[model samples]
Target: MRGKNVLITGGARGIGFGIAKAVAQMGGNIVCLDSLPEPVEEFKELPQRFGVKTHYFRTDVTKESSLYKSFKDAVDTVGDLHGCLTAAGVALDKPFQEHTWEESRRILEVNCIGTFFSVQLAAKQMEKQGTGGSIVTIASIAAQGNTCPGQRLSIYNMSKGAVKAFVGPLAVELAPQKIRVNSISPGITRTPMTAALAIQYPNLVKMFDRVPPLGRMGSPEDIANAAVFLLSDASPYVTGADWLVDGGLHAGTSRSLKDPSEQ
Candidate 1:
């Protein structure tokens, strides 16, 4: 990925930040976009530590205007993009009956609509450059369905399902342009967002452990490593595929069949 300009939405923190660091290590210049306040210290040290150029733009992925302008500015600052990671998203879980219209709308706007525009605009820029690029969106295992028994996330699940569905069509549509489109479906990962959940509901920690057969929750670095692979030259032929980064959760939890004494 050396000399490749990669744009990462929600790159200010968490998995997105992890992806940024990994890309820098691979010698790729980075354009980190997030609605959150700039991580001035981290961004400053990135170039010096990784020996690559880095730029950050505050962007709200929900708005097409904001997204397009940010993409344009990012391209102008760093040159044409070779890859884009659409990691900006939100997760709000509530029972179907209790969910207010406002809450459901926010989740759909951020997780589905925001992702849609982010990928669309990035592909447009990549198309204009006449150079094929890779685009990765952060879907979730929730798209499959809500796993935790007590958790109510009808709307959140629906939002992610939309993202999972969007990737296939977008990938096929952009195939002629050589712009690969893909998504990552992560399980219960230890992120800032989940940290709050853990604090609010201590029992969720235990619930999360039981879901992934690996006997542990995932980390930002875990998913970041996967994203880097898709963005790198190593996966030129890959597109339209949803990569499950949830450690064995999607495959079903492991279990002991019987005791040795029984045999």
Candidate 2:
């Protein structure tokens, strides 16, 4: 990935930050767009630490104009992009009945609509450059539907499901341009987003932990590792695919090895 320019949304923290770190370490120039305020010191020091250029812009994903301007600025600052990670998204964990229409709209706007436009904007840049590139969308294990009974996130699940489905057709369309589109469906990962809630309700976190067959929760690095692979040249022949980075959580949560004597 050396000399490559990669753009990441929601890159100020959590899974996005993890991905940014991995890309920078791999010698890729990074441009991060997020709704949060700039972390000036943190982003400015990235280049010195990883020996790669890093830039961060505050942009709201729900607003197309803001996102578009940010995209343009990123290109102007970093040159043509080699890869894009659409990690900007929102989550709603309330029960179906408790969710209001506004919540539904907000989640979809950030998680689905935001990704849709981000991919389009990034693809256009890649096409204009006449260079094949990679696009990775961040989906979630909840997209698989009812994966964990302990929590409720109907809107979030629906939004992510839509994102996961969006990749296949988009990949097919972009193939002619030598551009690849893919998605990563991550399970419950430890991040700032979930930390406060976890501390407030440790029992809920413990319940979710039991759902992963791996006997542990995931980390941002776990997802970032997979994102790097999909973005690298190693996956040139792979596209329109969904990589489930869930620690086998999608394989029914309640399972045990069969007794050899019974066999």
Candidate 3:
């Protein structure tokens, strides 16, 4: 990854920031596009900390105009983009019947539409550069199946499910250009977003504690590790694949009906 410039949406915090740090650690220059008014302190310190170039632009992925301008600015600042991760997304936890049309629209706009355009802009840049690049989108285990039983995420699930489905065809389309597109579906990761969710609904914490076969919630680094792999040259042949980093949560229940001795 050394000398490569990777673009990361939502790079101001959480899983995005973790991936940015991982990229920097691998000696890659980073260009961050987030809706934050300004870059955070840690993000600001990346250049000196990692001895690599770093740039941040305030970008709202839902609006193609905003995304286009920010993307142009990012390319002007960082040079050719070799990798991208579309991680800007939102979540809602209301029951399907109770969900308002407005609430549904917001989640779809931010998660689905946002991811769509971000990938488009990144691919455009990579295509123009004529340099094969890797693109990774953030999906969720919720899209695969209901990981959180009681917590309703109908709209959120639909949005991410759209993302998971979108990757395969895009991968095939981009293959001719040597651009790889894939997604990472994370389980219950400990991010500020999930922390707030857990606080609002205490049961979520218990679910996080018990559900994963790994016996713990995931960390930003856990997901970041996978993103780094997909972004780096190590995964040249890997594309159009949705990597599930859910600690075996999606594999099925860890519990058995009877003990081995009883059997």
Residues forming the 10-long window of minimal summed lDDT in candidate 2? 254-263
RMSD of 2: 3.2
lDDT of 2 by residue, 104-162 (tens): 99999999889999999999999999998999999999888755656777888899999
Better of 2 and 3 by lDDT: 3
Q: Candidate 1 or 3, higher lDDT?
A: 3
Model 1 lDDT tens row, 129-170: 999999999988888765644577788889988989999999
lDDT of 2 at 153: 79
Per-model TM values vs. the true structure: 0.93, 0.94, 0.95
**Model 3 regions more than 4 Å off:** 256-263
lDDT of each residue in 1-263, candidate 3, tens digit only:
99999999999998999999999999999998999887667887788988999988999998889999999899888889999999999998877899999989999999999999899989999999999899999999988957465678999999999999999999999999999999999988998888888778987676786667786789999999999999999999999999999878897644531246623
Q: After superposition, how far is residue 197 of candidate 1 from its true place, in Å?
A: 0.4
Q: Model 1 clash pairs?
A: none
- Each model's total of backbone clashes: 0, 0, 0
